[model samples]
Target: MNPNMTPNLMAVLPTLIIMVTGMVVLIGDSCLKGWKSTKSLSAIVTLIGIAAAGFFALSRITEDSIIVFGGAVVIDSFSNGTALILLATAAFATLLAMTYLENKNLNLGEYYALVLFSTSGSMLMASANDLIVLFIAIEILSVALYVLAGFARTDEKSEESALKYFLLGAFAAGFLLYGIALIYGGTAGAAGNGGTTNLTLISEFLRHTNGVANPMLMAGIALLLVGLGFKAGLVPFHMWTPDVYEGAPTSVTAYMAAGAKIGAFAAIVRVFNAFIPISPYWLIALQVLAVLTMFGGNLLAIVQENVKRMLAYSSIAHAGYLLVGVCAMAGNPRAHDTALGAILFYLFGYMLVTMGSFGILIWLSKRGHDCTTMNDLKGLAKTDPTAAYTMLIFMLSLAGIPLTVGFFGKLQIFNASLMAGQVGIAISMAVASIISVYYYLKVVWTMCFQEPDGNTVEGRATSSFGVNVTVGLSAIGCVLFGILPQTLQFLINASNSIMRP
Candidate 1:
């Protein structure tokens, strides 16, 4: 191994802190016996750890890139920014879990521990410099998620969600591993060395040999895309998303929706940025995938009666929108800063909006009422104006309506796409957003215009305090960032870091 390439502790401290926090929660939970609600202590621990990690990450928000752990991980503005986003997702989800699980009878120490583990895995994925490290991170995130999906053991649907996710996730891992092997074989041979999984080394080898036209390398790239495509909820690999999101506990669903997408896209950016030499070979395929995902996800969401499933499809559509920025970044060698900035901003917006949407579900839920379907939300405006208005903002944001975070995010992404010469995809994305408005507005019309269905809960006087905090923060984030995104200038630095030499 190259000595200069040795791993540095400072570089990975954030992820390490998160991992250590999970271990402590696990050990603490096992040793201390207390009221079921007291298990929320685990959540408290998890939040502190996440905030610490975020602090460490923010402290290192430099524009220059710094590789560590033999280049298996990197510390840069991009990594740090992404780490903050992951931490925020974990924090908000943990907060929601505090009250959410207590009500559902699923509150346990292990639940918070799993969330920390999953979030740390996502943090790893964001900074990974090697394909092997990325794969390991993916597994770490996926395994924790499988368990969290079914944490509500009494629910058959939750169990089913866990099973399906595991099976499909295993296959996707296979695809990624195989792709890594192929890239290694194809490039390492050219370098007269044994196969390696370090992305930088592979990129260097390919660049020296002008390997863009090499078939084996192309095959590997395609396979890697396939694997990542699944995690990002892109088309053809998205079958697992709806069932998983709808079946999993609402808090877990919120976690998966944002955390998973951010991590997957973070990896996608790293891989494609490394493979910029082979842009022609992969750009068209990716563009096609983006188009299919956007149209397909929106069309499917329009027909769904279940709000959770609609959000599932909506998540897929948002994934497609993000893909537009990814594809654009991959194609525009000189425009990565703009492309990445847009992608980062969009993810931030989507995270808050999606989290708030599901956070509302967690807030309104009763033991017998999941608050899942459209009918369940009828006349929600009449009984709970705050919840109704909150949902309205979330809905408008998702629909990309003017002045909402979602709208600005979409605007930035489309601007980036056009700058990258992806005019066709940009136009397609607009149409899909317009089409999405129908369903999004359908949600608004249902909650505002429709009468109360008997299905709506008499409502809870005292839901978990954590959920209210999550809802309030999410609501504030959506509008605050939408109106005054100047607060997010760190993201610009973060995006710029990824484009550095």
Candidate 2:
């Protein structure tokens, strides 16, 4: 089939593939007999579907951007880069969930199906070029995740987390939709034609018409921050993160951490990047939020006795770092590609660490018990030295210690900040990094030096090909990228490509 003859289909090929696969999975779960009854079948199907979609996305990386469906969704390098990250995260999460579900005896086929469905939504969000399209994509992802948050039907905390996520998420969605309405009203009045939600059209209106001076348009952008910032787990809007993370299954926690950030921030980058004339206004707000998020998240994490909650806070801090890169490009839309690329690279590294760390946490959990508190890790090095070593690496990476992906990722982001002459924020990052050390290292030191409390109960760490590979690869990736000088250049180039359209 000629691509030009069916541009809409071609542009949404991956999304369709993922959507169709989710339907197939739902069908399989409902109709399959004994042999297909195991949830593994569903997980396998989801993995295959996500893999196919990811391959399709990669193949289109060299193709020119195509805005289909009346310019609602645009396939471009920026979307592809973000889509690849979401796909990788889904793969790892699927693998983690397979074992997690089986062990907990909570292997509902709907779990994997929901993940695939949510992932497809994230993909759409990344490619969305219109406000209406973006809002729909956000709801698609959020609705599925709201259910998944409490997938463990018997757990009270799971139910609470799911409820909290849904309510807060709905509130955020209202803000986003209202922002879109305001923007549409402003544009319609200024452009003389009926209102439009398309980003490209909106940018044009701002540049070529009186839409720039429209108070409602600027107010709409501010409202957009409230909505997207909440989604990205920024401060004041971040209250839900720790509770939800600690309440949800570790596997789901891992998936949501990176996936949500990827989608929300992609929208943030696109908006700020395209609306260059409005940069000075939003940039100051983003910078202040970034600083608060950095210091606030790090400080809160420092006092957490629970590792899961600590990671929840850590996620917030990482979002702040990503925001810093955005602020670095505040005065220079030309730096959009480079700044976004740096954020993407850091996200990749962060994903690796989170997957491995939570994988270990999953392994430490036995049926009817969640392994999380810092005390539970005491004497882990004595019991399982290999696992201990892996944890050490992840901790070091999280702390931004040298010779790990996390280190280089921080270096690039900080370098971008300095280039933008945002020294105060850079210094805040440095201080936050130092303050973060005590907690990260505390985990390492506890694992290596503390003795097992006589009364402390522990689960036997299990081994399987899937778990081993996930953990090993993430740890290796952290170190491999750290020392590999060529990888950094490759990331820069890949990031540069995102703006080709």
Q: Please provide, for model 2 over 180-239, each residue's C-alpha lDDT reduced to its tens digit, 9 standing for 90 to 100.
A: 888888777444677778888777776775324467777888888899898999998998
For model 2, name the residue pairs that clash: none
Per-residue lDDT tens digits of candidate 1, residues 377-475? 888889788888999999999999877889888988898888888899999999999999999999889888988878775454336778888889999
- Segments of candidate 1 deviating more than 4 angstroms: 1-7, 33-39, 190-192, 460-462
Listed in order, each prediction's TM-score against the native is 0.96, 0.95
Query: TM-score of the candidate numbered 1?
Result: 0.96
For residue 498, what is the lDDT in candidate 2? 43
How many residue pairs in model 2 have overlapping backbones? 0
C-alpha lDDT of residue 322 in model 1? 91
